[model samples]
Target: MADNLLELDTPVIAILRAPTAARFAEVTAVLQESGITAVEFTLTSEGALDALRDCADFAYPIGVGTVRTAEDANRAVDAGAAYLITPVVSDEVIHEGYRLSIPVISGAFTPTEIHRAWVAGSTMIKVFPASLGGPDYLRALRAPLPDIPLVPTGGVTHDAAKAYLDAGATALGIGSPLIGDACTGGDLNALRDRALALREELK
Candidate 1:
């Protein structure tokens, strides 16, 4: 499972927060077509689990985010999520996710929290609100903790993705900028075009 997580060749991880299952599927299709092979559906999104199940056949990996409890982790696993991501670190959630042999990306904002998540068995340390400090922050954190795999999420734009990768980020989780309100508005073609442009920029 860890290998699978690491095998996500594309650096961009789309964060989808649609309000309906149909919109989620449509957005996911657009992203997948654009070469983005990993996506996250936050639990706050309505019918997120069902959408995950609905897209189970897609070659791309599907994940759950904002998971704060072991129960939520289990729900994601049962729904066939390829991985689990949290907005914050939680030992119980990490341990439980590991027991199920699913990769976990636990969110953290500080050096201590990032290291703690790594020690707790997180597959990757997600630097939440990464735009606040940008690449310089990740570069500084990695100086002492070079071995920890870090993925920067939140407020990441196409240009920011390159900066994060240059700053030693193992991967990126892109929201709004990649999978935006165009999904809710039923403009899948626009979303697809945006995803394609993002993929090209990452390339």
Candidate 2:
């Protein structure tokens, strides 16, 4: 992790992953209006790099997720991504993000993997598929790894946001539960509603 890691202004990192980024601008705008400042543009989404570049002047921090390769990390950095996120603990990806002076939110599940990722220099450990073990699982992990910041991702619903935070999550990575069909051209008003509700829940 770099000394200048992207600050998490909000607890939720809104994940926008769809077939394409055609709705990115609209979705992001609604999220911002709703007070959700952190966004993750997953490379798994088509045209994500170009979309990220298009948001060069976006008001908030937008990171690139699902980055598994160094080349992808470089491309994302070039595209103006504020940070990087990986699905698993990949030292290559972590090192590339470090070299680029970008923070990497490395994903891990087990306690060992979590510690390994932190040792590998990830800015934060994303407890992927967090729904599998839920908040109690996070609480257990925090018992021993109190110093490491954790961000629970995957199936993070608005209703469960506070529970995760209370379980020691530094932040959250919310996808479909918060996004719904917004990124796929669903209703922006509905997206705003969800964002607002989620933000309020966190508060």
Candidate 3:
């Protein structure tokens, strides 16, 4: 795989933010069983990069999230992260993704912020805290910037996943909603079930 996240027909990035690296494998397995191909292991976890490397052999895109600096971006690229995801728009990090030819999903909410992230070379613009505005917010943003690949991440749930997509989201960046407390309780089956439901809903 060339590790391009944008190539997927159903672009759903399963944001896995577990407390322990031990659970990463199980969660990843469940997601894969449910046909989830794009995943992001947040940097907050102690062994996120290690988890990413371990899953590098999987036939899907695994990326690093919550990236705030160019150094972290560079490190993630070196660690074999297929893409980079950020909660905020950072010029340095976005530029680094461009230089590395790794897709970057930089987060922003407002028109100005979204546009800035796009111009900074982010492969996709993530609308962080999107729940605050809901799918309607994305609809408004799309009015003017119809070409930007807006990814509405954070606070997105399966019940509302289709609406966001209908509102113009290129993809959905889902976290706890899909993984749930499975990471904490080690419920791989629960995560798998949710992933299946989500996949069906998106259809």
Instruction: Quote the positional error of residue 136 for candidate 3 in Å.
Output: 0.5
lDDT of 3: 0.86
Q: What lDDT is obtained when candidate 1 is compared to the true structure?
A: 0.86
Candidate 2 per-residue lDDT over residues 1-203, each given as its tens digit: 23323345568888999999988978988898888888899999999998888888877768899999999899999999988999999999999988888899999999999999999999999999999999999999999999998999998888889999999999999999999999987899999998888877778
lDDT scores of the candidates, listed in order: 0.86, 0.89, 0.86
The alpha-carbon deviation from the true structure for residue 96 of candidate 2, after best TM-score superposition, in angstroms, is: 0.9
Per-residue lDDT of candidate 3, residues 1-203 (tens digit):
23356555566888888766657767887798788878888989878888878887776667899999999999898888888999998999988988988889998999999999998888899999999999999999999999999889989988899999999998899999888887677577778788888888788
Model number with the top TM-score: 2
Give candidate 2's root-mean-square deviation (CA, Å): 1.6
Q: Give model 2's TM-score versus the native structure.
A: 0.96
Residue-by-residue lDDT tens digits, candidate 1, 63-160: 89989999999998899888899999999889998899888999999999998999999999899989999999999999999999889998988877
Q: What's model 2's overall lDDT? A: 0.89
Better of 2 and 3 by lDDT: 2
